[model samples]
Each structure stands twice: as C-alpha cells, then as structure tokens.
Target chain A: MSIDVLLQQIVNGLVVGSVYALVALGYTMVYGILQLINFAHGEIVMIGALAALFVTNALIAVGVPPALALVIAILAAMIICAIVGVSVERIAYRPLRTAPRLAPLITAIGVSIFLQQIAILVFGRNYFTFPEIIPKTPMQFGAVIVTPNEIVIFVTSLLLMAGLLFLVNKTKIGTAMRATAEDQKVAGLMGIDINKIIAFTFAIGSGLGAVAGVMVASNYGQAHYFMGFMLGLKAFTAAVMGGIGNLWGAMVGGLILGLVENVGLMFVRGDYKDIFAFVVLVLVLIFRPQGLIGEKVAERA
Target chain B: MSALLENKRNQIIAFVALGIFLLILPFLAGMIGQAWVRILNITLLYVMLALGLNVVVGVAGLLDLGYVAFYAVGAYTWALLASNHFDLSYPFWVLLPLGAFLAALAGLMLGAPVLKLRGDYLAIVTLGFGEIIRILMNNLDKVSLPGSDTVYNLTNGPRGVTGIDGLNFFGFKVRQGIEVFGHQVTGLQLYYFVFLAIAILSVWMVYNLQHSRLGRAWQALREDEIAAKAMGINVRNVKLAAFAFGALTGGLAGGLFAAMQGFVSPESFGLLESVMILAMVVLGGMGHIPGVILGAVLLAAMPEVIRYVADENVQQKVFGLVVIAPEVLRNLIFSLAMILIMLYRPRGLWPSPDRKADTGGSAK
Candidate 1:
C-alpha cells in the first residue's frame, strides 16, 4: 500500500485502539481485584452504545442540540452500564466467589448470555442506526486524512485514560483500591471497605467502557445487541496483551492490538480481521504469559 | 419386585431393560413423530460429545474452551474426504479412523503449548485457538498467493462442504432405510440406532478409561498437580492423554454427525457448541458417566422440546400471543438455568457418590 494508505490505517488503528484500551481498563481493574474475567463486560459496552443510541435519538427528536444530546446520552449510558456492571457482579459473581473456578467461569458465560438476551428482548435483533451527531468533516494532514469523529474518539479516550490514571494514582480511593488489590484481607483489616472499593472499581471502569462504547458505535455508524461479544473478546485479548492486572499494560495492549489488526488488514481479507486479535492472544499467552507490562504474579492455589 | 431383584440378577435385569428400551426407542419416538427420532439421534451424539469433554475438563480438571475445534476437525475431515468437495469420496470406515487420528494429533499439538498455563489462562488460549480454527475454516475458501494469480480453494468458505456421503457398511447404505419382515424401517430410525450404538460404545470406553490406572493419574493430577508429581505420576503425559483421548472421542462423534447430517459447516462448531457441551458435563455431574449422559439428553433435547411445547396451542392459548420466539426463549431458559445451577447446585444435578461422601453433600 501507499504511504497515505498506511498513515490512514495507523490513524484508524489508533482510534480503534483507544476504544479497546477503554474497555480493557474495565477488565484489568476487575481482574486486579477479583481475578475474574467479567465476560459480560463487553455487554456493558454494548448496553452503553445501545442506551446512548436510544437516548440520543429521543433527545434529538425533542429539539435538543445534537452535540449536547450526545453528551447527555453518553452520561446516561455510563450510569446505566455502571449499574449493569455492578449488578452483574453482585448477582452472578458474588455468590460464587468462593466456588470452584469452573463455577464462576460458567456463571460468567451465563451472565453474558443473560445480558445479550435481555438486550435483544428490549431492542429488536437488528442493527440500530447510530446517527452521526458529530461533524463528519475530513481533516487532511499532508497525504493522510482523518475524520472529526476519529479525532474526537481518540482525544476523548485519551482524556478518560488520563483521568482514570489520575483517580487511581492521586486519589485516596485509588490508594485504597491498590491496597485492596494487593491484599484484600489485609486491606480489610486496614479499615478499607473492600466491597465498596471493588464496587468503585467496577463503576469507574464501566463508565470508561461506556465512553468507549459510544466511540465504537460512532465509528461503526450502527449498534447491535450482539456487537459486544467480539469486541469484548478483542478487548480481553488486549488486556492480556498488555498485562492482565496492570492499567498501563491494558492501555498499551489495546493500542498495539488495534494498530496491528488494522495494519494487518492490508495483507489479508477483511473476513480474517477478527483472527488477528485471537492469534495475538494465543501467541502472547504461549510466549510471554505475563504480558508486555505485567509483573509475574503467582497463580492463586 | 425389589426382593426378586437381588445381586447379579439386578444388574442383569437393568442391563436387559436398558437394552430393550434402546431397541424400542425409535419406534416409541416414531409414534409421536419421526422428527423426535432425529432429535434423539442428535441427543445421543451430544452424549458422546459431553462424555469426551467430561474426560478433559471434568476428570483432568483442564478447562478447554476450544474442545469443539476437534469436533470441527473430525467433521471437516469427513466432509473433505468423504464428500465430493475435491472429488475424493473415502469410505466411512477409513474416514472414521482417520478423523479420530487427526483430531487426537491436533489435541496433542494444542496440549503442548499450554501445558504450563493454569485454569482461566488455559481457557482463554484454547478459546483463541478454537476461534482461529473457525476463522481458518471460514476464510480458507480462496487463498491467493501474494503477487500471484494462483488461488487455492479449501473448505468451500462459509457455504460449507455439502452433500457428504452417509455411512455405508460394505454395500449397505445406512441412509437408505430397509424393510424387515414386512415392516418399514425409516432412515431416521436407522440413524438413531447407529447413534445409540456409538453412544453406548463411547460411554463404555470412557467408563473403562475412568477406572484405569491412567485414569487415577489424571484424578491425582486434577486434585493437586505438585502432589501428583511427588507421587511419581507423569503429569505431562497424563494431561496429554486426556487431551488426545477427549479429542479422539469428539472426532468420532463429529464424523458420525457429518455422516448423519450429510453436511458440515463452520457454524456448527462455534464456541457456543463448546459451552453447550461443557454445560452438559457440568450440569449432569462432572466426572460422572451416568450424570453426564443424563445432562446430555436433557440439554440436547431441551430446545426441541421447547419448540414442540411452544407451538400454537401453548403460545396462543397460554400466553395470548408469542412475545418472544421459541429460539430466544430457549436461550433465555438455557442461560437462566446455567446461572441458577451454578449458584445452587454447583456440584451439578447429580454429584458422584464418592464426592458426595467426601464433601458431605454440601453445595459448596
């Protein structure tokens, strides 16, 4: 491909990667504390997109400005998905916390199916048009071109990532979270309400995922109930690529996965695009199971 | 009756009754509809699949989310070799052994890489591997060389390999129903017997394996890997054996499935199929033969039963109208059952007697 095409792919990859990073944070944070995969996390992203789609469309119909409507819809989606993420954990995961590994894993799969079915019951089984609320004007930089939506997605994702870092690093709750993740019993002894910290982690992570969901819907120009499964798998792969429990690892992993997948599309048919993330996942697990930025954590016996 | 059934007589009576029941199943099911016989055949096939997965995840304690990949391997092998896909139509006897062998080899290959990975990590890797296999099956239809005009067509892409040859013994085609003593035997009934026989063979084979010396090694390994190593068990070999054995069983089932269906496609071997099989194993009672069979039958027949029950009589009379389709309702019920069972009956619907005694039958 030509230089412009390569640059365009890179730009596309960065946009997609940011979304992956945003979702990966949810997985990494939950895994850091609970060591659970949260298979339904992707559905949270889907809910965010569909919820945003519905809210935005309704708001636009009622004479709300498109830009303002988008903002409100995203906030609403974040709140709704935060509730969903927390409730899933509370209902499906909490009871099985001390159960066998197989139990929790199976339940996670069940919860994922449950959410997807619920989504289908509420929203019909077809794709809903995600209106372009933002300007779609193309911005040309030398030989390369990028859309305004892409720039917004990338910038918003970066800002959210930065804000998350700030919250986890500079805030007291962040310190508590780190302590809880390090040793839940010890943190509990230290007067850190372990459950609350865990809930906060889910909330913050899911809210970020909501923004990512909106970005994904905006990028694709449509939203569907089943859209979350593949995207969730890819984001999970990204989380593993970076390092499961590390926030920075998830960010780097998502971008790398995104860039590689988009750039690799030049050499293969688009039908094979989903395979790239999975291939990367298997290779990474086989070669460097700790991931790029992950510390070697011992498996809990 | 209870006093009459004593000792060896009880075993003999049970065996004879089971045999008679199986013999009459096609006819009994045919009384309702031939479609029910087909469903029963599919259920028996799932019994084999669940029994195979039981060896891996249930007995060996290795979570393989890609177990269906082996089934795909066997199905595709049969599809390619026994179908007119490439104009090579191999006999069922040759295809069966070959499919099982290839699937076993794939299991070994898959086992080698993730031998050190534990639990969820192994699960994710296997899941990825399964997806890779599926994507390859979906996209390998037309593979063009870079900067070359030559293209290779394999797997026929997503449309799948169709019109596969059915099972034929010598000159007898199983698909072509036969008559005996002026009685008509439908092809579906023939397939039912074939599946039932295969299921019985598999269950017997797996039952023997579960009690073998190697089986003890697997159980030891599952309980405690380090302790098993200390006990002089060859952990690596035992794990590989589980993988290979399970894959072999899955392959056998897959080949039979392809022959019966006369078609094989990528859609049939998705992750959902793997999860479904795992559910059967878990729901029945992991590492328990009879329980696994029960689970397989219940889950495999569930959707069809739902479809039958949700017909116009129930949909219009009971619910007033069909708000949700039977397909969606099946999934909803299936998912809800999974969550609820894992929550309350974590040991499954029927826990093994030994495990029950060991844990005092506690849910935990």
Candidate 2:
C-alpha cells in the first residue's frame, strides 16, 4: 500500500486503539484483582455511551450550549456507569464469589446479556445519532491528513489513560488494589477493607470504560445497544495481548491490536477484517499465552 | 426403598416407560399441530448439541465456547454435498457419518494445538476459533481467482445455501409426507421421529461413554489433571477424544438439521447458540445426563414457552395500557432466569446421579 494510506491507517488505528486501551484497562484491572474476565465491562461502555447520548441530546434540546452539554453528558455517563458496575458486582457477582471459578464467569455472561436486553428495551433497538461536537475541519500535513475529532479522541484518551495510571500507581487506594490483588485473604486479614477496594476497582474501571464509549460513539456518529459486544471482545483480546493483569500491557495490546486489524486490511479483503483480531488472538495465545508484558508465573497445571 | 430405586430391574422399567413416551410424543404434539412438532425437532437438535458439549465441559472440564462451529461445519458439508449448491445429490444417511467425521476432524485439529491451555486462556482461544469459522464462512461467499478476475460464491456469502435434500428412509421419503392413521403425516412429523431416534442413540452413546474406561480417564482429568497424569492417564489424548466426540455429536445433529429444514444458513450457528448450549450444560448440572437433558429442553424451548404464555390474546387487559411485549419480556426474563438459577442452584436443577451414589443414590 502507499505510504499515505499506511500513515492514515496508523492514525486511524491509534485513534481507535486509545478507546480499546480504555476498555482493556477495565478488563486488566478487574482480572488482576479478581481473576475474573468481567464480561459485563463491555456493557458498561454501552450504557455510558447511550446515557451520554441521551443526556447530551436532552441538554441540547433544552437550549444548553453544545460544548457544555457534551461535558456534562460525559460526567453523567461516568457516574451512572460506575454505579451500574458496582450494582452488578453486588447483585450478580458477589453471591458467587466463593463458588466454583466458572460461576462468576457464567454470571458475568448472563449479566452482559441481561444488560444488553435491558438496553434494547430502554433504547428501542435503534442507533441513536450522536452529533459531532468537534469541528470536521481536516488538518493536512503534506499527504498525511487528520481531523479535529481524531486529534481530540487521541488527546482525550491519553489524558484519561494518564489519569488512570496516576490513580493506580501513586494513590493509597492503588496500593490497596495492588495488595489485595496479590492475595485477597491476606489483605483482608491486614484490614484492607477488601470490599471497598473491589468496589473502587469496578467504579474506576467502569468510569474509564464510559469515556471510551463516548469517544467511539462520537467517532462513529452513532451508537447502538449492541455496540459493546464486538468492541468488548476486541478489547479483551487487547488486554490478553498486552498481558491480562498488567496495566501498561493493556495500552500496548490495544494499540497493536488496532494497528494490525486496520493495517491487515491492506493485504486482504476488508470483509475479513474481523477475523484478523481472532487470528492474532490465537497466535499470541499459542506463542505467548501470558502476553507480551506479562511476568512469567508458574505454568498452570 | 433405596434398594428398589437403585435396582437394575427398576432402571429397566424406567427406561422402557421413557421409550414408550418418546414413541408417542409425536402423536401427542400432532394434537397441538405441525408448528409444535417443528419446535420439538429444534429442541431435540439442541439436546444433541448440548449432550456433546456435556462430554467436553461437563465430563472433561474443558470449557469450549466454539462447539457450534462443528455444527456449522456439519450443516455446510451436508448442504454442499447434497443440496442445489453443488448438486452432488448424496442421500442423508450417506452424509450423516461423513459430515460428523469431518467435524470430528475439525475438533481434533483445534484441540491439538490449544488443549494445553487451561481455564480462561482456553476459553478466549476457543471463542476466537468459533468467530474465525463464522467470519470465514461469512467472507468465503466471494472468492476471487488467484491472479484472475472471476469471483465465485463458495459459501454463497450471507445468502446461505438452500434447497437441501430431505431424508429418505428405505423407500419412504420424509419430504413426500406419508399418510398414517387417516391423517397426513407431514415432513416435520417424520423429522420428529427420525431426530427422536438419533437423539436416543446419541444419549445412549454418551451415557455409555460416561461409564467407559476412557470416560473414567476423562473424569479423572476433570477432577485433577496433574493427579490424573500421575495415575497414568494420557491427558492430551483423552482431552482430544472429548473434543472429537463432542464435535461428532454436534455434527450429527447439524447434518440432520440440514436434511430436516431443507436449508442451511450461517446465522443458525452464532455465538449466542454456543452460549445457549453451554447454558444448558451448566444449568442442567455438568457431568449429569438427566440434568443436561432437562437443561437442553428448558433453555431451547423457554422463549417459545414464554411467547405462548404471554401472547396478547392471553392478557386480560389488567394494567391499563402498561402492556409488556412478549419479545422484550422473553429476553429479559431469560437473562434474569440465567442469573437467578446460577445464584440459587449452582449445582444445576438436576444434579448427576454419581454424587448421590454414596447414600444408595439418595439425595444428600
């Protein structure tokens, strides 16, 4: 392919990769702590995106400035999604905490389907148009072109990722998160309030997921009830690719996954784009099941 | 009481009674009409798929999220070989075992590379494998010739292959709709009987499998792989056997489905179908035959059952226009049911017989 097309694909990949990175962070954080895949994390992103769409449209209808409306919508979506993440943890997942390892996994899939059904009921199974708040002006750099939305999405994702890194690395709660992850029983014995830390994990993870949701919705110009399934799946792949339990690995995995998915289309038909993620997934899993960044643990029996 | 219930004599009696009931199931469904017989056929197909998955997830402790890909493989093989897609014109009986063997081969191929992975890693890989098959199917409809311009439809893309030939049994064709007992026995009814036979055979085979030496090896691996290996079980071979057997069962059902419906499509073998089959095994209680059967029937038929009960005609206009659409409630209720069942009855609605064997097969 031409360098211009390749450069454009890279730009597009990074923009989309940032959103995937955000979603993968939720998966990475939760898996690191609970060793659960958190299948419902994808739905949180959908809920946030839809909720933001609803609030922003409503605000605009009420004559609020478009810029202010978008900001409030994002905030509202994060709060609402965080609450949802906690509730799902409490109601569906908590009961099966001590059950078989697969119990929570099944529960997560059930909740993912249940939340999708709920979204279909509330949102009427149609795509809601998310108006473009950012300008559509194309910025040219001598054969490499970009849009305002792309730049905004890339910058916004970086800021959010940076914020998450700070919260997980420098904060006291971050220490609790790390401690509880290493061994839950010991952390609880040390009076770490494991419940709060777990809940906090869900909250932050879901909030970050919401930001990704809004970014994707804005990028695509619309969002639907089932947008989370494929995206969530890819993000999970990214999380695994980068190393499931490692934070920084998630970011790298998402970018790599995104780049490969888009860039691979240059050689093959575009219709086979979805298959590339799975192909990469199986290859990575076979060669480096722990992912690129995962520290080696004793091989599972 | 324990002695009588556990006696071989009583078991024979129960088996006979079940056989007699299944023989009459079609006639009973006929009273409701042909539409219901069709649903019963589909439900039976699900039972076959679920049973195959039971051998893997239930008996062997491998969570396979892509089991339906085998079903797809079987269906497509039958359609391409027997349908208008290629006009090869093979009979249903000829294609049944062949399709199943092909699916088993696919299973072996998949299990060989990835069987070493455990738990979630295995799950993600299996899931990817499933999507890979589906996407490949979806994209193979248009294949451009190497270095040439002609594009041929291999899978027919999303349009799917059609006009699959129906089953013909010993000079009696199900599609011809034979007359029996002064009533027209439609093709659907014939399908019900044939599929019922296949279901019974699959059950018998799987039941035998669960009690055989290989089955014991599978169970040993399930309980503790390292320990099983220490006890001299070939872990890889046994796991691969479980996968192949599961695929074989799924493929048999898929080939039969192609003959019964006279059509084949990619949509039938989706991730949701895989999950629903897994749900049957999980909800019915893993490693238990009777429990798995219960799960297969309930989950497969739950939506239609809900639809039948909640149709607008049945409503008494109770809530002053707060009417709940059946489709919406069906999905919501199904999901809630999954969550609630796992929450309350993690052992499944009907647990296996072995767990109760300690107390003369009595409830613990």
Candidate 3:
C-alpha cells in the first residue's frame, strides 16, 4: 500500500468511526441508566437518516439553499427521533421495567422492526440518493486526500460529543443523570425525578444518534431503510467495547472500531466489514468483560 | 370428557383434536389456495423452530439473540451434503440427522466459550457470533491465493446453491406434484404433514424433557444460577445441554427448510428471523410448549393474512395513503403486537402452567 492509500483508509475509518461513536453514545447512555440495551437505537439512526434524506430533497426541490436545507433536515430528524426514542421508553420499556430481563429486550427488537417498517412506509425499500449538500471537492493534505463531507462528519461528531461531555460533567442535569444511573431509588430519594431524568437521557441520546444517521448517509451518499441493521449491530459492539455504561468509552470504542475495521479491509473482503466490530465485541466480552475503559463491577449473580 | 381432559386423558383428547385439525388442514388449505398450504408449512416450521429455541431461551433463561445461527448451520448442512452442488444426492433420511448434528456441534462450540458470560454480555456475544457467521457466508465465496490469481470457491455467495434434492423416503420421492387419496397433494401439503410430524416429535421431546431431572435443573438455573450452582446442579453442563439440545432441535427445522425450499441462501437466515422466532417464544409463554405453538402459528400466519386483506388490488387505504404496500404494515403490526403484549402482558399471553405458582412463590 502507498502512503496516500493508508492515509485515505485512516481518514475513511475516522470518518465512519466518528458516526459510530455518536451512535455508541446512545447505546451507552440508555444502557447506563436502565441496564437496558436499546436495540432500536440503530433504527432511530435509520429513521433520522431517512428523514434527513427526505427533508433535504424536499427543501432543495422548494429552492432552499443546500447548507440551510441541511441544517433544517438535521434538526427535523433529531426532533422526530427524539420523540420516537422517548415514546419507545414510555410505551415499550417503562411498563416492563420491573419485569424479567428478557421482556424489555424482546420489546426493543419489536420497536426496532416497527421503526424500520415506518421508514419503509415513508421512504421506499431501496436506496435513495442523499442530496449532496456538502461540496463534492476533495481536499489535499500532504499525501492524503480528504473529502469535505468527511470533515463535516468528523467535526460535527466531535463538537456534539464535546457538548455532551460538558453537559454531563458541568450541568446539574448531568449530575442527576449520573445519580439515577447509579441508583434510581437513591436518586429518587435525593429529589431527582427519575422518570424525567431517564426520559431526558433518551431524548439526548436519540438526538445524537439521529445526527450520526445523517452523517453516515451523507458519507455513503445513499440512504436505505435497511441500513440501520448492520450499523446498529456495529454501534452496539462499539458500546460494549468501550464499556457499556461509560460515555467517553463509547467514543473511544467507536474510533477504534472504525480504524480496526478499515485497517483490516486490505486483508478481508468488503462484505466482512460488519463482521469486524462483532468479532471485537465477542472477544472483548469474553476476555475483558468490563471493557477497555469500563470500571469493573462485581459480576451480577 | 372433562375427566379425560383433567388428567393424561385430557392430553390425549387434545392431541387427538389437534391431530384431526392438522390432518384436515392441508385439504382445507387446498380448497382455499396453494398459498394457504404454503403458509401452513411455514407456520409449522416456525412452531418447530420456536420449540427448539424454547429449550435455550425459555427453559435455560439464556437470552440467545442469534439462535438463527444453528438454523443456518442445519440448513447449510443439508444443502451441501444432499444437494447437487457437490454431486452428492443423499436421501433426506440420512441428511436430517447429519444436519442436526452439525448444528448441535456449533451450539456446543458456541456454548463453550460464552456460557460463563451472563446477562447482556452473553446476549451481545451470541448476537455477534450470529452476524459473523452471516458475514462469512456472504463473503467466503472466493479465496484468492496469496501471490497467485487462483481462487477457491466455497459457497456460491449471494446467488445461493440451487437445484437441491427434495424430501424423499427410501425410493418414494415427494416431489412438487404427487397424488394421494384421490386429491392431488401438492408437495407443500406433503411437507405440511412432514412438518406436523416433526412439530409433534419436538413437542413430545420437549414436554418430556421439561419434566425430567435435566429440565428441573434448567428451571433451577433460570430461577437463580448461583443458588442452583451452590445446590450442586452442575451449571456448566446444564447450560451446555440447553444450548446443544436447543441447536439440535432447531437443526431439524433447518434441515426440513432446505428440503422444502430446494435452495439455501444466507438471506433466509437473518437477524429478523431470529427476532421473530424469539418474539414467538416471548409472546407465547416461555417454557410452555402449547403456548409457544399458539405463538408460532399466529406470528407465522398473520403476516400472510394481512397481505391478503391489504392487497393493493383492493380499495383498502390507511390514512388515505392507499395502503398500496403491505410490506410496510406487516412489520408494523408484528412489532406493535410485540410492544403491546410486553406492556399489557409481560408474562406473555399464556403464562406457563407451573409459573402460575412461581409468581406467588417469588412474592411470598
């Protein structure tokens, strides 16, 4: 491989990784709070991506500027998916909160399929051309050539992640979130509204996931209803890899997952791209079940 | 009759009624349409698959999200060994056990490494394993020699292996068209009987196992793994048995599926199928054979029923959107059903018979 070739792969990996990190944050946040694996998080991304695709196309058709259209598209998707995320919690998950472990998880799968079907209904089954809002020119940096969209994906994901970090660390709501995640009853006793905190967590996490969906669609240049499955699985793997409940760990895990998957592309075929994240997940769960950055806890009996 | 239903006689009567209903089903299906027969065939397949999976998910209480991996293994085993792809025309009788054996082996292999992991961790690993198998299947068609241009073909990739042998017994081949009892029995109707037999066998086996020592051990494990282990239940062996036996049962479904479809593709075994089957177990009461059968039939048949009613040819419209595409609503209905069921009846539509007592025990 040439110098530029390796750099290009790294750039592609980082771009994809940033989106994976964003999606991972959703999975990690929900998992942290409820010890629930939000299986539909990927579908939220799909819905967001599809919504963005439709809105951007519609806006451009109505003669809106590409940049402004993109902004409106992202915002609409975030709002819709945030509602979707919260609705999923209130309708499917909350009722089964005290139920057996399997109930909510299976319900999550149901919600996933439900969301995908809604996407299919709104947008047809096949891939749609995502409107090219970003300029189509590639920027040359030494031997590496990066596209404008890649920079957008990387910068947007980082800024959002940094914002989230600040929200969780500096804000009172973040402290409440941390407290509830630690112990809901104790947090409730401390005058934190557990329901409100959990709902807020879902909204914020889902909004981030929607943004990732838009980024990934722009990066790939196409949006499909079915695109959520593989990405969702990969993001879930990334969440596990970063330590399930740890926020920053999800970001680190996403970047590493992207790099590893892309770096292995030379040896493996493209179809094997989705397999890399899963393989890492199985290995991490087996050897270091707590994850790379996750603080170890006593095994649940 | 009440007395009969009150004891073993009740089981016999229920079985007889079920037997009669099932026996007349194909004819009724034939009267309705060939498509109906196909639906029954698919439903029976789901029933067997759900039962096989019940051993792992329901009894053992290990939430295996990737149960379809065993189903794929079983299907492929029959596809490769019995199909013309390898020029090996083995009979279905010989291939069935072989297919199931391969799946059981896979289950054991999977069980060995991840059985120690618990809760969501175990669930994620198994899910990953399922995806890995699928990706490998999709990508493992050609292997280029390191420095040479030579390529080795394993599976045919996406196009899939076709022209596989159909179900046969000794020399009596059950092909697409055959006559039996003056009615022209389509191959589908014949397969329905075959599936019914398999479903019964799986039910019988599961029912017996559910009451056996091993079954109690599984029940114990599911209730409290640490307590079971402390009580000398041999958690590892029990867990492995649940995984292996579950795979073996699922393999039967897969083997017959290959024979029925006459083609095997990775697409047939996807994450959706696994989740659908899992939904059947969850929706029907877990660990309850009869309830699972109910779930299997409903889920498998409902989509086809909706497709019929919501046909674009009709004037049906939802929200004035023409309802032209039923695919959109099919998943929506199932998922909606799942969410509603979980919300309203988290113990499932039909709670296990003994679990009725379990609720009070846990409470007290």
All-Cα superposition RMSD per candidate: 2.8, 3.2, 2.8
- Judging by DockQ, tell me the better candidate of 1 and 2: 2
Sequence-dependent TM-score of model 2: 0.95
Worst 10 residues of 3 chain B by lDDT: B355-364
| Chain B TM-score, all predictions listed | 0.94, 0.92, 0.92
| Residue pairs in clash, model 1 | none
Instruction: List the lowest-lDDT window of 10 residues for candidate 2 chain B.
Output: B355-364
Q: Which is the better candidate, 1 or 3, if ranked by DockQ?
A: 3
Best lDDT among the predictions, by candidate number? 1
Ranking by DockQ: 3, 2, 1
lDDT for each residue of candidate 3 in B19-112, tens digit (9 for 90 to 100): 8998998989899998888888889989999998888888888878889998988888888888777788888878899989989999999899
In the range A1-301, model 3's lDDT, one tens digit per residue, is 6766777888888988999999999999999988888999999999999998899989989999989999999999999999999999998898877776667887998888888888877787888888887975888999888888889889999999999999998999999999999988889999999999999999999999899999989888998988888889888888888888999889998998998898878757777777876876777767887787988866542
Instruction: Please state the CAPRI-style docking class of candidate 3.
Output: medium
Model 1 regions more than 4 Å off: B1-12, B356-364
CA-based DockQ, model 1: 0.45
lDDT (0-100) at residue B194 of candidate 1? 85
Ten-residue stretch with the least lDDT total in model 2 chain A: A292-301
> What DockQ class does candidate 1 belong to?
acceptable
